[model samples]
Target chain A: MLADIEEFYRLDRLPHIWCPGCGNGIVLACLVKAIKELKYDQDKTVVVSGIGCSSRASAYLDFNTLHTTHGRALAFATGIKLAKPELNIFVITGDGDSSAIGGNHLIHAARRNIDLNVVIFNNNIYGMTGGQYSPLTPKVQKATTAPYGTIERPFDLAKLVEAAGATYVARSTAYHTRLTTELIINGAKNKGFSVTEVISQCPVSYGRRNRFNTPAAMLEWQREMAVPVIKARSMAPEELEGKIITGELYRGHAPEYVSEYTKLTQRLKEEAEGV
Target chain B: MPKDPANIGKPEVAIKDSWCKGCGICVALCPKKVLVMNAQGKAVVACPEKCVGCKMCAEHCPDYAITVEVE
Candidate 1:
């Protein structure tokens, strides 16, 4: 299909490297749609990805995309945001890439409140590296490393980022495509460290091990478990058991890092001129 | 001259077969069952007439193989 989005993608990279039913593709699509909706200059938009199946998106997208070291997408994106604050920066990362290997960077970036839009593709496992359990993998979910279900609790990434001081934080799943796209758009518009954790499906790895039989079944599970932010507020703790909250979880207005830095430098320059 | 008057302004469900991974996500999520997986494991437009133009299949294809345009 020669759709409008076709131009935003590297046509030669047709049929992305993602596996069949990989939710990474859906998230990627949502991201591109967000960019389109915002009318952001493709030339001025930068897409940064860390090492993983999700990181492979950089190669397929036609914009200025950087496929960086494992779990360092945020660092690279931070540098880009600081150096070229005029550009719209986006980080596409997996749960393992961001929360496990890049956990420190994720929190630090959020604390700084940089104008970086991050979409964590939380597929719950290290899919590209053979189904190893990740920091976001639910407790008791079986993985290659955890042959008999893990005892450790998974990180609530949205809450973690919100607590870490991100100006905008949201969560959505692949099943909620429209909402995912909308949240991504809002995340980009937040003008500070914005995190949109998308609960994606790793059918080949996380799904089969977890007995989700098929990718469609995994998507269906997301649909059943998801509750909008408004609905979640009324539900009691016990009633919200096993429910995934979707939608804009938090939005705080804070001075963006790059802009603040520019102001500081401008002030310093004026002082130097006065001297 | 358009051959089918009923087909006028119908939603266009375009499936790029080469890119389809035969995931059947579009078929499964389609509210109208307008798509089905072919014998070759690729998604195909089974009932173009039944399309409701929701674009659920297009949005969730994961493969980006389906593009539905509602005229």
Candidate 2:
């Protein structure tokens, strides 16, 4: 199926830093497959990431990559898009990198409807920092920081991005590889800010601390929790509790930021020249 | 590539042990149950004859450890 995995990666960086059975590889594979299917120009594509285990993806991919400061991937990506509107940009960020400290940037990016694809690798806990409870960590979940349990509720990533006015929003788990790849392709094709929240597994950091001690168990848990968006529609909210509603959650046409800026600058120049 | 006599006319499933984390996903997802984790915690072909070249294990493997070749 995906025969060209090596083509999308920097072979010198082989043997990624993620632990065995980590779902980050699966998400990366889906991303590579989506890029292949889209036949995007690698020279014109930029992969940006924030500080985290997931952010390490920028180093592995063979693209014009930018590994930015912690929780500032979208902000950096915004500058890149505004400077060079023709570039295809993809921001790979973790739950904590996006929703915790970068929450304001994420929401504002969606509000501005910038044409950039954002894929949030939501593994619940901050795996790179040794299992700190993140904004998307489910309530009552045990983390290194919250050994007893987390008291705060988690952010519904898809709903948050959708409410913030992203043109395309979708959710899928690492267990659903095909769906995740397809959703990423669709998100890249969308004209405005698109967020695809992939519920990934962090076996070493999150699983070891929680009851899911193995990668298989963590993946099985995701498999059991995921419900297709269409099927979830027929079920009541109470019945659908604790289920991951996967598939495209929202899609709307909007004015993309970079294009609007280009138009504004062109009109200003024309008025100045008295054309 | 010349076919090995041992696997001549048979589908070959190769597992890169170095990359495999012994997650058992390939074993669990294999429709024919042709794969299983060995004592060393690496996936091994349990029933190579039953393998239909479906590549489910290869597709689902998080480590990219499994590859299927069908003649």
Candidate 3:
């Protein structure tokens, strides 16, 4: 049984849709590793995703999956949670699909502290649809939509989730393979809502438009951007600029939606028995 | 570590010449440096020995002309 899980997660799915050196494959591997480590009831684990290159996850993973409309993954995932609270729901989306079109769903899901694991593949562009600007595309970065440079500020996903009331939040990149896997594993184990933002690379669209011409260069950028959170605390904001921060951004305990509702029902049962 | 280029499987990385569009994205991003743009501006696996099967070319190719298959 364990062997089945291991073999299923192999990188044999080529030719992959992402660029050859793109980090989405690495992030996908880490996610599968986390899922295997948890040994959650595979039948009960549902992978819900929206439209984008990252959203292609549903087609590859061997689990109950729902490939929903663009930026509506969270809405469908919410319905799944409300109907089958016992199941472990995971929402896989891209920076644009989730943060731009699906932003409200993301905030409300976190606000409820729902028992869902959200993995945002932040490649900084709308890759699957075509090279386009996304909400998380860094300021001044070149994209198909932004020929000269992007003017809008990017969203710091980890902080956004924490602010929205997600119980557990972490950040990692495709370059940090082991660390990313660990974060996903921990996020899956958390009882309440968990979010793991995986900063992946879009070598074809994002990299080519920008100065990063090679996959190695893209990988190097991921390495250079990452700043361990413990070290980030003491460093100046200037030091943190152009650097990716990877680690447990925030983790707190909250009454999980399903468990709390179950408790409420149990308490009502006890009161009725006394009557 | 020096990547063993010959150890990369497949006799020779071949791209359907007609399918190629002279997009140098593959030439720029290949970690193995196996591909190069010929005078026709078409991507060719000039140094198949350097390929690592990382799939960067096939992944980056906008036209889906590149294929990395195992022999």
Candidate 4:
């Protein structure tokens, strides 16, 4: 089986460091499947990630992977993309890594509409740093920091990115493996900034505290909570509450950052030559 | 016993216990219910005959613990 998809991963780095029942692997597999289906040039594709369990995926993929500082995967990826516009850049980040520390970068990147595929592994807590509640953690969810249940509302990451001007925005959970892969593939193929928020499971860190003691239970929760975007359209707001809307939520075209920059450079060169 | 042509050289689900964390994603996702967790919690192919080589288990296994191969 490994032989079938050997080119997509660095098998030598197998036995990944993620804890048992962690959904990061499922997201990773989906991403690999999407890349394979798209037939992207392996040599020209770069996987960038920030500090977190999900970020560790950069090391496992056999692409031009970059493990950047905490909350700075997009920042690093921005530079990489500007320098080499031909490369396909995919940024892998976690909830805490992206929504909290890297919140500003995420917004700016989306606003710029850069040609970057961003996948957020939203496990609701900081799994790598000990189950702390993240910006995406639900209002009543228990976390190390929120022992008595969180008081603040969680960030709707897909909506946030869409509002921030991302060309593509979608959401999916680990249980919806096929949907996740399809959304990711579409996100990757989008011309401008694309964000796919994968509501992953942190069984050990998140589940034990939230009564979802096993990966299967957490996934089942995801299955129950996820409603397709089209189906969700017919449901009332009240009925849609607490349910994740999965599928392509939005897709719109805009001038990608790299191409805009190139045009600017050409214009400036023409002006200089005229002078 | 005469073997059906469709059943001849059928694929078998292989379990790599050392890598399997017994998450049961494969068990839940198996369309044919060909797998079940044993006493040790690791997934085992309970009915290989039911396996249609959909490879859903292989594709979704987080641990890369299950693989389907034709003998």
- lDDT top scorer: 1
Error of 4 at A87 (Å): 0.5
- Each candidate's interface RMSD: 1.5, 2.5, 9.3, 1.9
Which one wins on DockQ?
Answer: 1
**Tens-digit lDDT track for model 2 on A164-233?**
9899999999988889999999999999999999999988878887888678788889999999999999
Task: Please give the range of 10 consecutive residues that has the lowest summed lDDT in model 3 chain B.
Answer: B56-65
lDDT of 1 by residue, B1-71 (tens): 45378788888788988899998899999999999889998889989999988988988989888888888
Query: How well is each residue in B31-50 modelled by candidate 2, as lDDT tens digits?
Result: 89998889998889888888
Top-down DockQ ranking: 1, 4, 2, 3
- Off-target runs (Cα >4 Å) in candidate 1 are B1-3
State the TM-score, rounded to 2 decimals, of chain A in model 4: 0.98
Q: Tens-digit lDDT track for model 1 on A175-202?
A: 9988998999999988899999999999
Expressed as tens digits, the lDDT of each residue in A86-178 for candidate 4 is 898899999999999999999999999999999999999998888899999998989999999999999888888889989999999988888
Clashing pairs in 1: none
Question: After superposition, which runs of candidate 2 have C-alpha atoms over 4 Å from their true positions?
Answer: B4-11
The 10-residue segment of model 4 chain A with minimum total lDDT is: A1-10
lDDT of 3 at A123: 93
- Every candidate's chain B TM-score: 0.90, 0.82, 0.77, 0.83
Per-candidate interface DockQ score? 0.71, 0.49, 0.08, 0.52
Error of 4 at A25 (Å): 0.7
Q: Is the docking of candidate 2 incorrect, acceptable, medium or high quality?
A: medium
